[model samples]
Target: MPQIVCPACGAINRIPPGKPAETARCGKCREPLFQGRPADLDGAGLARHITRDSIPLVVDFWADWCGPCKMMAPEFVKAAQALEPLVRFAKLDTEAAPEAAAAHGIRSIPTMMVFRNGREVARQSGAMPAGQIVQWLRDAVLALGS
Candidate 1:
């Protein structure tokens, strides 16, 4: 089992790999937490959480009005479902979390940033299908050796 800090309600959830979708519940809000997108994070939390978490984080920086962002949402969700045990996925709405967007220097919607040990390893901007997203994760994880 692994502990996943829920971005939805800021609850630290202990989730087993076998039942991530079932076991994932926010400790605070009791909300069903694991949604297949980047977690919206603020300045300090984003810096600390990404750096401290053991697993790789795939963050999707997006906005509600962006067409490409909407187009990639489903693909992101699918990718999160397939890669649950191995990767921690989150979605950040730039409009909602402005400070986080600014700290990350996000200039566009649909920008995906892969982080390990709080350090950015890879980033890409644009819409990618589930296959490509999975492939990118595979390569990124392999490159990180974890």
Candidate 2:
């Protein structure tokens, strides 16, 4: 079984392998696990997601005031749409969740980090197009096996 942390109610749900994640709902909250959209998380929420989830997590640390962050928002959404079920996508507002940003040592806005098993496996800074974001995540996942 794969353990997934629910973004809505912060409950941990166990899902059987070979079952499509798109249709899997949280056992406690009844919310879809893979919504094909990035979940907006605060500091504590971010911590719980990263620490508890067994799947790969990609977090975009952004700030509202950043022009690049705003520009990349839609691209991130597109990427999330393409990458869900394989990767869990999340976003954190650096301005609102400074503690999470600082904990991750994010000095720049629009920083993306890939985490697996509560540890960072890859990181990329700056804004990118949706295709590039997807490719980057694919490469990161591939590298994890090497």
Candidate 3:
């Protein structure tokens, strides 16, 4: 069995083998495990997702005051819409979670990091369109051989 961290409540849910995780629900919160959009994360939520999620995670580090971050928000959501279930998309506000941002060494707004098995494997800093994000994430993940 594999464990997935619920996007709704940060609860760890074991996924049975040969089951479709997209249709799975969190036992603790009874919420659908895979929502078709990026989930917003605070410091604790970011930590939980990074440490506990079984699937690959793409986190966008952004701040409210950042113009590029605002511009890329919809594109990020579009990428999430196309990549959910197999990959998890999340956003961490640097303004609100400064410590988390610093810990991750986020030097720029709208930076993205891809994590697998509790470690960062890929990182890119920029604001790109949905198509580019999806392709970049897909290539990075495929290269990981997961």
Candidate 4:
């Protein structure tokens, strides 16, 4: 079973293989696990998702005041729509979570990080189109196998 951490209530849910996780709900919160959209997470929520979830976690570190971040928002959403069930997408507002940003050593807005098993596996700075983001994630996942 794959363990998925619920973004809403931080509960861990076990999912059987070959099951469609897109329709799966959190056992504790009863919220849909995969909403086909990026989940907005605070610092603690980010930590929990990264560490607890069995699926790879892709986090977008951004700030509301950043023009590039705003421009990349829709692209990120599109990427999430294409990548869900294979990966989990999340967004953290750097302005709201300065400590988390600092902890991640994020000096630029619109930074993306891929985490598996609570550790960072890949990172990219700057905004990218949806296709590029999807490609980047696919490449990263491939690299993990190597």
Quote each prediction's TM-score.
0.77, 0.95, 0.96, 0.95
Native-vs-model 4 lDDT? Answer: 0.91
Per-residue lDDT of 84-116 in model 4, one digit per residue for the tens?
Answer: 978999999999999999999998888999999
Q: What digit string (tens of lDDT, one per residue) describes model 2 on residues 19-80?
A: 88889999998999888899999999999999998889999999889999999999999999
Which stretches of model 2 miss by more than 4 angstroms? 142-146
Worst 10 residues of 1 by lDDT: 36-45
Candidate 1 residue-wise lDDT, 79-120, digit = tens: 988886467787888888888988888988889998887688
Following a full C-alpha superposition, what root-mean-square deviation does model 4 have from the true structure?
Answer: 1.4
Task: Give each model's whole-structure lDDT.
Answer: 0.77, 0.90, 0.91, 0.91
Candidate 1 residue 100 C-alpha distance from true site, Å: 1.3
Model 4's TM-score against the true structure: 0.95
* Clashing residue pairs, backbone N/CA/C < 3 A, model 2: none
Lowest lDDT sum, 10 consecutive residues, model 4, at 137-146
Give the range where candidate 3 is weakest over 10 consecutive residues by summed lDDT: 137-146
Off by over 4 Å in 1: 1-3, 12-45
